[model samples]
Target: MAGPDLTLDQARQQANLAFTASGTEFAFGDAAALPLPIAQMKALSAGSPGVETLHDGGLTAEVLCLKHAGRRWAVKRARPVCRVRNIEGQTSFLNELQRHAELAGLRLPGVIRPVYGSLRDGLVVSPWISGRHPGVLDERQARTLLETGCALIEHGFFEWDYSAGNLLDDGERIWLYDFGYCYRFDPLTQFNSAGHGCEHPRHHLAERIEGRHLFGALLDAGNDDEALPHFIRFKRLAAQAYVDLADRLARRGATPPVLGHYRGLAARWHQELAHAPGLLYLASAWQAHSSDLDDDLRGRSCTPRTLQRAQWLQATLGAQGHRLRRSGALSPDDAALDDTALLRRYHDREVEARRCQL
Candidate 1:
């Protein structure tokens, strides 16, 4: 009566099949009617008068702002050799192009659409988005990001990286312009595009946002009093969003664990929001910082935040490790480590982070 459930890798292959078959190059709409002439757009050098090099953008690509015919467009040229030196980094541009096609077809909100791209040419062109990466998010920005993330999940796209560079805020809504790390999975039966999909149940939309953005933003808050309020607000929003997400998935015939995962998170967050919000904040912050720190280390693309996260982990283990243990914040492997060992590990990581600074 129905097709068999697919593994995460299978799902990804199916999703990108057409793109692969079509030689992995794509251009949306009539190229003849494109906003900028593709030849001229590609030919323009970084030092050209009207071309502005935004930043190195690190590892995968370089972006330039092109002022053509009075309109600004962002021209992203993939590096001949990706700096991150991993399979994911090497293939990120093609993955992004695939996601752009999928998202454009879905007409998903809060995502900036690219006008043209070619994998072979190592180029992607989209209208320049006028926005800033805000260190701290207000309610509107936070809610918008949550909604966009939920939409991606509900539609089977798992966005792994929500780093500051991937998001932009135009004073009203947050825009997701980077899909380099986003992948597809069977949302009806899988948690994410990792470890056979459902094996890593702890990874989810809220977890990603916290690990990649929220906790980093909270790092700026001078004290618990300043940060607690923001965490509380985010927890409240995320809990409700999960509940709503669970309901939508249930209607789509999602599996029990998938349903329970969101429901459990919502219930726990709600309970904590009422009684032990501080514990919730502490446990989540510890987990977030630690997870992101590991990601940076594994990628060998550490940033200043990686050092900060490592220091936070060291300080937390030294000061509140017992509480972390009680709160079940430590991973099973981490739980085995004594406070001294944990502190030493993080201290070493901090040094490694300094060496790998991007």
Candidate 2:
């Protein structure tokens, strides 16, 4: 195996690159290799013929698709100003530039690497992946995404946002192209890149997929009968993936707590999948939806799906607050609220979510 593209030391040094008044130039390999010259790439505009503008609800950059040398390429330009008001939003472009280099080096499958990028020029170029954002996930698509995500975790890259826009399916395989929100963490010791790394165990790989994408797809299901089968399939896959992840991390000398974490989850999921899968689904659904809603609210980038998620929470709280509480799905504060109080709280959140639409 060639191993990953950059060593930890090299990745750290690259991350510290500073932008001067003249702007820092960055590239994965040969910037001269692009079909278009750097000057022409920097001057690309949406109005130009043969350019197809893509507004994928991205907050930090504008994406344009065009043909070059008989092939399609996606040219992403950083927005003059990012839409989200947070610090992470402000610096995401530079962060992505850094990730682009590291991921290019790793050369992981299904992860599209940029041919060239320049932070100073606020540009990145990659072959345009030929796929659409799946409105719903079949078993094959779900397993493909899960396998790809697991591979990333094993390599210490934690991808936070697996939203619909960040994914594509070119008939045969799913592709992950964006790296703006992907960050490095110690796979042997930490659960994720969130607060103090291991402090947030709820932000694991399955939670992210379930919260950001799967549950959203389930929201359109007519009833539990329709959604239950899909959730079951995913949970089965996740349990096995956790088992494999735990084994790999253990061989790498992961700490006891980290190993125990994955093993415990696998055990519990297996137990639940055999006996009380409904409770498992309910608990995971509550956590995933609530967490994702909070993320959007904090980032001030809520969308129509955000509103729907808020509504789902409110409705679920009304109909199954008791079940959620019994299933240990509710947090301490949420567990304390009565049904009416919980309903009212989520209703307020729904209104706020609508106000924050990007």
Candidate 3:
């Protein structure tokens, strides 16, 4: 395996980016988006932030439901220490502050509007909308997700995390809240902030959804079978989103090569959607399964999906491993395992991963 994308010294510097306690005032981005003044927000966060409506996972910070004036808001106070422990986790809060600072005043439908944020005070306050975390992503939700995701990429921000916990639908629109994992990248040239950029262009917006949100839902046999239709729906939406995205990028004066790069994946997916939906499904499944499993193995944050992916790989190898292998779907490690050894390996890993799950 190659070394980490960053040098050891760079990693150390990144890992040290913890939140500091200072009296630095929360910079209010949109006072109009807030129900209360900056003083009220400061007071609410001066101590343990109140929990009017609780949130599940912050990983990098403590999230609370803030009650101010006659409204509720989300106050994400940076924990003195982050739960994620990695360089991304260590710097996530600071990264969020930076992203929010850029997106503060933008009137984007899919992005959460921040009322206030700060580096020293270690928190951000945004209006609390009564929203639902989607289960089976409906057509509107799927379309909105790709639309917004493309928008972020076009604007030079690469949002890395798209897990269910980070998204909310207020019935009218979908909103992206967490920016701790979102980083700045060249929209016109880079594939993502992960160093793939245009060099490895396959990792686009739809792939992010599959890894972070969709595939986890397809945890078992029944859901896995159902995933085909869900994926098709997303692909359809994404095709249209790409069309709009390419036009917008061109208008923004993106270079022709960059514009061509943006349009290439979309055009291919569109053609496949028209002529060979099944091929697209197989390709997508292979990519999603391979990518997500590697993510778990690397992070070692295995959930049921880790087990499911392993099982799926074993099944695919038995049935059509040759075909998948020819198509570059099977990883070198996966290709090396015999049936008995693979099952045995997955079972052991599954047992270990289960302990980490709940």
Candidate 4:
């Protein structure tokens, strides 16, 4: 059967109206009335046996835990008014459901299976992932998680919301949940000249570092000093990766948005490295606590001090070129300074250091 036909905005309005009309406090019960097949409703109830009324968190939407077909699932409904400017989350969630349904049997978590209705006020039911939110893992665990995450990203499983709270660790293994904002990262198709095709670069970088640092802190048992270095290295590596990806896109004649994101990230990293040298050093020192040192050490061995210096040099080169571009006074010699070359050198040096240390 075809799914509900409604724009995210329409869905949001319908959800809000349903919430108000039902007077059920939580919109879950009311949302259920948004026209679903009787059989599907019965199946949902059967799947989530113990669900009845659920809690409501006042945000863009209301979420409810329900029992359908003897299984428990989360039902999220959008509000009536479009308070949030970007409908990315709503769109991404709908996309995940569609994509995951097509690629069933993958190890990844289930999407909004049986989508039962439309994007707005829709009922998405996936098995609840069990375990506490993932934090920094010990050296062994961190390596495992990082490799796993990288592999996932490479496979086009880019979860825009990779926060610690979104990850659940069941002691034996880690399962990613809350994939409402996940997207397929297509290097070729998903680039523009203004910025990357995905979310803002700063938001992406901040979320990535926050997740990595949380992992680092967990590995160090909440010792900020010990986790500092890992945070620095993770940030640098992430920024480098972003810049490299942007360069590749630029070479393909991608839009300025794509290049802009990379440039922004590179500039940010350079600024941080120059002004907050101590922070980077502290982050590197904390790398000792990463569970993934073996993977890091498998490449070049970079001292905290060296990484900082290299980052500063690269940033300076980039800033000079940017200034020239803005002022329309870029000399051939100044333009000759290869930003990509400097970035590669820093990347290789850091990888080598990490490998050696491991």
Candidate 5:
């Protein structure tokens, strides 16, 4: 939606005007009962500034905690120069402001409520949610996240990022906040916003949860004796979530291809659960965790979990090369290699990955 004539700053200013004209709720100047205008939130204090500043908040903006008058709010300020540099990255802050305009009134329990936002001011405000990222997800959390993802899908919003940094669990429920990567898509007749959501059936709600959050934690868990049981538990929950998602989407008049996508996913997991469940888990965990790790490294956003996953992959390739090969997680060339060769290959990659470790 940005243009060459319009600088990023100009584009942002335009976005703010567009949203304001549409009557989105905005709090400022002692009207909405805030301690400060959204723009001034970044300077809440000298060094504190009340910024949450999540490491995984992506490269476009700085997320800060804002405490005003007796209440706390999250005031995300767009960096003067976005770190991402790509068109999507360059325009993400504006995108989030626009998305907030659409979501400001939707009282979805799983979705975070947007209080106010302004691209001109380079900030958006929302209530601050507090909770730990329960490294391991239980059924309740998994169900909540997947169901909310499905709701977003049904409503034509396709969210691309589901990283741990974008979510919070308040013990009772999992809350999704960031909308920087969220885009529009057709839910009934087409795939996600990319093409038709059906073309890449692999990018499901459950898949996002596993790749973004669950698999990384399993690395922290260590060893198959422990990780396998944890995965099996989640797989069972995922299977059910898929069933419920498919049913809900079906009633919403989702197209056959779309419905088939969800149902097929459920059937595969259910079928595998009845038979080759562990094999399924091993292959999935390896692919999900490994791919997610590669993503972090590519983004130069390595976390403690990223380093742990690299170590785990190296050890697993060394200890169970045959099983990993059979799981089809490694590349075909690597899989065809002997145990010693495969282990060495992974070890070298692990070493490179560690170089960027934080």
Candidate 6:
């Protein structure tokens, strides 16, 4: 007789088999009893009543609904490809969930409450907060939301993937979701302020804001001229917040990867400021292309050549627009002066100059 077709149990068994073959442990659980409390789920769902597909972005499966217990939540399941063929991809996802759990209570989205399976066949659940996109908010509202989101990250010592889609606004409040890639920073590299990697990822930001109708609406609201300046200032403040938190982490002797990551980040911010000065004010020109900063800043793969070009652009733009100042104090000839200080200074000078000009 041929082998029996796999039922849910059989499928789960297969999943376990696959995980074991891949040198990982696979433990099964009662699906009905999730790690998170049913009460917490009900409170989060606010009586939404049933599971509904919120997003099917192809990479992951997402279901939004109120559990039978009356709590709102989001359940995320990796695609079969991730489970079977791309185990490493699943490992990243699992790592993300673990990080989220560790970083809970930082006013960030809740943790990935593991449910019903080992790492290979698990479901991750988090609270569902209803909100609109930042691009949809009015100028004042958008700025406030962005500031709040950044502030949350600052306090949490967590770096969020700031792509537009991960941010949501629900009329009165803005919410950030999708914490699978979040990580803690080392205080030393993070606090140095002159280290690298402080710059926001432009490509991710661009992807978030592009094609959002609300972005166009914001641009058309007679405030297109101010958006770029607002965003630049926002980014600077956010970077500083990260630096401060990272410094704290460093003092505690955080992990090497975490320290290195923030160091790289601080450096990036400095480099961007020294090089791509035009990008600082690009948001103001949004109306001309009907594209918001988030959309326009995507996929900015930088290299030595691109860095040189950005620096040239900065010099060229500095002749017309205001200049950015270096932030923290440094020796006049410190070769160790990484790009971070220069960028912070540049941001400070530019913002101050713009304020005066306005």
TM-score of each: 0.92, 0.91, 0.82, 0.44, 0.82, 0.46
lDDT, candidate 6, 143-180, per-residue tens: 54445543443443343344456666666555655654
Where is model 4 poorest over a 10-residue stretch in terms of lDDT?
Answer: 286-295
RMSD of each: 3.1, 4.7, 4.5, 15.1, 5.4, 14.0
- Tens digits of per-residue lDDT for model 4, 1-358: 2235553334544554454456533211233433345345334432354556553533344445665465555554444543334454324444544444433435433222333324444444445544666555444334444544544443445555454545566675565545555555554444211133444333343345353345434343544456556556655655666666567666777667656766686776667676874444443332322212222343233235334433433453454434324432233443454667545654565556544431
Top lDDT prediction, candidate number: 1
What lDDT does each candidate get? 0.83, 0.82, 0.71, 0.46, 0.71, 0.43
* Over 4 Å off, model 6: 1-49, 83-90, 105-118, 136-160, 170-173, 190-226, 229-279, 283-358
Show model 2 residue runs off by greater than 4 Å: 1-23
**Per-residue CA lDDT of candidate 5, range 1-358, in tens?**
7676654345555665566457555432221544475435645433564543543345777766666566777667778788876656666877776666776666666888756676666766678888766677777787777778877876777777877778888888888889998876677776666533445666666777788878877767866678777788788877887678778778888788878877787798888778987778877877786777778778766777776777777776766667777776676776677787766766676677778765
Q: How close is candidate 4 to the true structure, as a TM-score?
A: 0.44
In Å, residue 280's CA in model 2 sits off its true spot by 0.8
Candidate ranking (TM-score, best to worst):
1, 2, 3, 5, 6, 4
Misplaced by over 4 Å in model 3 are 1-50, 220-224, 332-352, 355-358
C-alpha lDDT (0 to 100) for residue 293 of candidate 5: 77
Q: Give the clashing residue pairs of candidate 3, or none.
A: 191-197
Instruction: Please estimate how well model 4 matches the true structure, expressed as its whole-model Cα lDDT.
Output: 0.46
Query: What is the clash tally of candidate 1?
Result: 0
Over 1-358, each residue of candidate 1 has an lDDT whose tens digit, in order, gives 1235765555555555545557756545345544567777667678876886666856798888887788888888888888867556656787888788788878777988777777766778888888899676678988999999999999989999898888999877899988988998889999999868878988999999989998998888766669989989988999999999999999999999999999999999999899999889899999899999998888787888888889888887887888889999998988888888877888988998999887
Instruction: Decide which is better by TM-score, 1 or 4.
Output: 1
